[model samples]
Target: MTLSEQIPSDARIAVVTGASSGIGEATARQLATQGYHVVVGARRVDRLEKLASEIGGTALQLDVTDEDSVAAFTAVVPRVSVLINNAGGAKGLAPVIDADLDDWRWMWETNVLGTLRVTKALLPKLIESGDALVVTITSVAAFEAYDNGSGYTSAKHAQAVLHRTLRGELLGQPVRLTEIAPGAVETEFSLVRFDGDESKADAVYRGITPLVAKDIAEVVGFVASRPSHVNLDQIIIKPRDQAGPGRFSRK
Candidate 1:
């Protein structure tokens, strides 16, 4: 890390979940670049360590699906000014009738419940910090349901609800709540959704240009950097080629 990227002693700490890879990793790297002492959390200890070392931040082994792990992660952080909940992904492209219960469970656990656990754990610190930001990464599916996105869509919508409730419930507080919903950002998302089937995953964004993890990460930094008086409730960004859920311009 260069001197320019080093966080000052007085800078408020930023915590990002799922920091091992994808958007979480990108957000951590971007926040570190913005002079924040970023505390990264994920289940993959080795990757987290490497990311922390590379970005000059600290890493904690955290499994958002586990209450104990979330607690342990919060214990390691002295204070938190920004909390980015990005530990979510699609499980399977199954219809509602053919949905696998296990896949749905995993999606719910990771997307909705994971956000609940981490936010509940760190919220007190954010409240005490006076000025804080909470950014939750949802998906376009949260607003528009599709044929094969039953489980993923429902789970992401729950995250969106959680974000909305937080904003309404925390009115007048210094803490701000923002939800970022992106459309078809090419990352590990497709691969994971297809159960590591490279061909299936590759087909999701075959001909059209999709958004990247860094693109969303940059937006996160922008939203979080706004003036304290300005609260951006939500940002729904899609690639120019993506019109909506299941609508893509293929070349």
Candidate 2:
């Protein structure tokens, strides 16, 4: 279905974070195409400007980990119908015993704390919209803990539970919370996780066709377009080659 057709008349303004690239980028474009007034945010001002121009959406400089930045970012939107929290990532894949404290903190700050910062800042706007939606891009790691992914796993799992707790808090409110968990998707995710190691990132999907960013973006569109009474609480999507967390069948 088309965006205009999918969007409820009461909810048309959609805000997407981490929109410089990957699933965030794709979702921003998709929402705009679907007729929502899309507001895209990220640290890369130039890239966001380009994307905003391309999609006819507003672009803002936002650092989810920074309170001041998030405050400034949300302050501009008079009203919002959807908030996509895609501004999280993994740092390194070190085992628990070999983990670096700093790495763990960065992961927690970016994944868990970052989501909290943005949500807290924007919840008021969303609640004001009458029938708003909040969707987050989590990971398959949220459910399965792997050997070398202690920090990332913990952060994701924390975020997953965080949303569940939020649902209870907003029970009577007209806000819907959705979490989109993806498995083995090919994007800058691995590059960032491995600290810009090109070969290591490429090796991640060498044998298997992974889910691209647009795949998740499409899901976001569907969730955003649904009726006000329907809440798609969580969607766990993975490539056919991926069985579970760290379980991939490469060709």
Candidate 3:
């Protein structure tokens, strides 16, 4: 049967990490619109509260890097049929030679280990739900690397591989795993990468109609709304003006 048919009218539980802004915020809102009781988790409780109130979902203060936060967040969310792993980002853009080891460590800790922590803590609840779905938001850097992209790229690669392994391991289970790799999405990602340099972030998408948070959100919704038998393993989304990593057209 179709996904809509499979999802009952009664509240279906959905847990979305990094739901304070960008794609995470959009996903939480979209899921709630789809009749799911979404639990939005992030470090920014104020933003999360605003979003939750607007979307009619619950907001929980969760820092994915903290074990206690992960455990507490999952504990509060009684049931979760869908898990969106979207809490990850990089801080620096430097070549390996000049790159700071601390930056790399931070990226891996948050992008890779953080995801693992949240997933593992919530897996039992997901499995018990019998129709669980896990959607991980990775990046194009996972497959293609450019100068100064090592730290972020490596972390994304780890996340992608984790999803791949999970997909294989959960073959027969009711849960399904998916990885989405988005390229050049115009969001706070670049701003965070550039340390709040608005101009630099804007330059990244200057001449191109890059993907927006809503774009990724729509894709997440589509994947989640598919039939239970159909699993979209990996999706690579990019703006038409951008060919691949570090290749964007200037008009």
Candidate 4:
């Protein structure tokens, strides 16, 4: 049966990390529209509250980088049938030789361990639901790497592998694990990566109409709404102008 059919309308709970903006925000809104009780989590409480109010979902303050924050956020929201590990980003674009060690550590902490912390805490609740789904938002960098993408690429690869391993472990279980990887999304991702450098952020999507947050959200909604028997392993969404990593079409 489809996920919407398998899940009771009232009891369907989804915990989406990084839900304040971008794909996380869009996904939370879309899921709420599909009748899921979406619990939005992020470091920005004000933004989370606004989004929650607009989407009619619960908002929780979460900093995936902190263990206590993750614990508190998970404890407050019970019965989560879906966990979207979307709290991750890249910090610097310098080459590996010139990159700072702290930047690499930060990327690994958020992209890999952050995802682990949230998923580990919610695994029991998901198992209890008997029709749970874990949708992780990875990136196209996971499969392909280019200049100045060492740390981010490595973290994406690790996160993707973690999801793959979890899917194998939960082979017979009701939990459906999947990953969504997108390329050149026009979002605050680059802004965060450049530490609020609006110019650099704008440059990332200068010539191309990159994938928007809603584009990724639509794919996520479709995947989460699929039949329980049909598991969409991984979906890679990219703008038509962007053929692959670092290969954006420019006029």
CA lDDT of every candidate: 0.91, 0.90, 0.88, 0.90
Tens digits of per-residue lDDT, candidate 3, 1-251, equal: 53234445467889899999999999998898888888889999999999988987788899998898888788767778999999999888898889889888888988899999999988888888889999999999989888889999989999888878998788888998889999988878989999999998888898788998999999999999998889999999999998888898978
The candidate maximizing lDDT is 1
TM-score of each: 0.96, 0.95, 0.95, 0.95
**Residue 62, candidate 1: C-alpha displacement in angstroms:** 0.7
Predicted candidate 1 versus true structure: per-residue lDDT over 116-164, tens digit per residue = 9999999999999999999999999889999988899999999899889
Cα RMSD (angstroms) for every candidate in the order listed? 3.2, 4.4, 4.5, 4.2
User: Runs in model 2 with CA error above 4 Å?
Assistant: 1-11
Clashes per model (N, Cα, C within 3 A): 0, 1, 0, 0
Candidate 4 off by > 4 Å? 1-9
**Tens-digit lDDT string for candidate 2 (48-138):** 9999889887888999888899898888776788999998899888888899999888888888988998899889979988999999889
Q: Which ten residues in a row have the lowest lDDT in candidate 2?
A: 2-11
For candidate 4, lDDT tens digit of each residue in 1-251?
43335445566899999999999999999999888888899999999999988977888899898999999888867588889999999999989789889999999999999999999999998998989899999999988988888989999999899888998898898999989999998889999999999998998889788889999999989988999888999999999999888898976
Q: After superposition, how far is residue 47 of candidate 3 from its true place, in Å?
A: 0.5
